[model samples]
Target: MSIKLDQVVKVFGTQRVLDDVSLTIAEGEFFVVLGPSGCGKSTLLRLISGLEPLDGGRILINGREVAASGLHLAPEQRGVGVVFQSYALWPHMTVAGNVAFPLETAGRSRSEVTRRTEECLATVELTRFADRKPADLSGGQRQRVALARCLAQGASTILMDEPLANLDPHLRGAMEEELSAFHKASAATTLFITHDQREAMALADRIAILWDGRLLQADAPEVIYRRPRNRHVAGFIGQGSIVTVRVTAAEAGTAHVRLGKAGQDVACVADTQPGTAALLLRPEDIEACGDEGAQLCGRVERSVYRGGFHEADVAVEGLDAPLMVRLAGRPAAGERIGLRLRSGWLLPA
Candidate 1:
């Protein structure tokens, strides 16, 4: 199912939780809405699910208007299933019973419900645990049960609200794989909501960054990370340093910019013109080099081991903030190092 939101608005008290948010999610696409806490991510989901009414604009599902002036479809009427962070499984029911609940409620025959429940359980590889109660399953297993129940609903679209937030680091990694497999097996259009950028990057066909009741940027994960539309989107999507640079020359999609008293060329949008502009230098863009061919030099102010590599803050002479770089080995504080500008993005003026 495809979802289209045109100038959707939702308010609470004096606050406009969602302000004129608009986007189109194609059918069978894994679309993710990412934002920080208290950023109306949940409210946006509720409005789409018909749990909350829109104050303005319209929402359509597969070309049919589900929400607009004076019209609101109930959750069940939307043909979308939801998997919440809590899993929301019935405590007293076994795995099979939970998966069978929706089918039974909709008046399917007993034999049909039983057969469908078994199919869903096998899809999630939980047929062995079909007789186990919710309390007897692990966190990941419980989450799978919720997914199986959603599958039983035969929903064309699925809405997930931070469904992996409650899992431990190790379990979260495992569930991510499972979720990807589940989506393929179900072939459902998924609208997943989460604050974790890492998770968003991993699972999304496209990602929408929602901040302060508005949609900032919506694009593929690589585009959002590499060429953010604005400073806010650049800062929010990944770790990087935004430094002021002088674009000495620019043509095509490359810009020759001066950074901290050194000149180097980097990638930029084609519209970029020669002048002063903000440059986004990711950790991978700055590399340690020998003094013979260094583009910039800095002092390592701090270094910390980040598992396989060390992340260091390099304080250049004229830049306001230190540039972060990944090092193969930890460097001593105040040590001088030569760096090469491998690549960077010039923010739109």
Candidate 2:
């Protein structure tokens, strides 16, 4: 099912939790809402799911108005199944019982509940543990049970609010795979919310980032990473350094920019307006090259080992702040090195 929000606004006391938010989730698409903590990521989910009242704007599910002005549909009527951050499983019930509970509550016959429960359990690969209590299951298994319940509900639209937050790192990765597979198999319009950038990148068909109750951006993962709209989006989506650059020239499909007072020039693959602008460079975008071969030269100020790579902070000659560069080999603290941004996006100043 397709879902749309038009100029949605939510406020609490004097705080505006969401402001003039509008978006559309296409049928059978996996969309993710991503942001840092307290950025109103969860609030947007609640608004869409009919769990919260909106101060203004409209919500449409399958082109039917669900929330607008004084009209608000009940959560159950929205035909949206929500898997909360807590999973919200019944503590005293077995996995099968929990999965079947929603169906039974909806007036489905006992036979239908049993059949749907079994089908959902199989979908999540939790059939063998159908009769087992949630407490007896591992964190991942418990998460699967929650997912299974959503499946049992037969809702074509699913809203997931950090359902894997309680799991450890390893389990989170495994669940991410399972959730993605489920999304594909079911072909549901899924809107997942999370604060984790990696989780958004890993699971989303497209990601929408929220900040201070404002929607900063919404785009395909690669586009958001490589061509962020502004400094805020560029800085938040990845580990990147924002450097000021003077746009010296612009063409039909690219721009030539100069960095620092020395006029170190580089070509950005964007049709940017010519003036002062910002350049976003991820750690991997900067290469450690020979001193004479690279566009910018710097001294290695710090190098810290991090698994397969070293996060080196370099003191560049013309820049005031240390430019972070990721390298496989660590350079000495005082070693002079050459640096060049292999690629970056230029944002209007």
Tell me the tens digit of each residue's lDDT in model 2 across 229-343. Answer: 8877888887867877778887765677776544544546545777877777788778988867788888888889989999988887656567889888877998888787776
TM-score of each: 0.98, 0.96
Clashing pairs in 2: none
In terms of TM-score, which candidate is strongest?
Answer: 1
lDDT scores of the candidates, listed in order:
0.93, 0.86
Stretch of 10 with least lDDT, candidate 1:
256-265
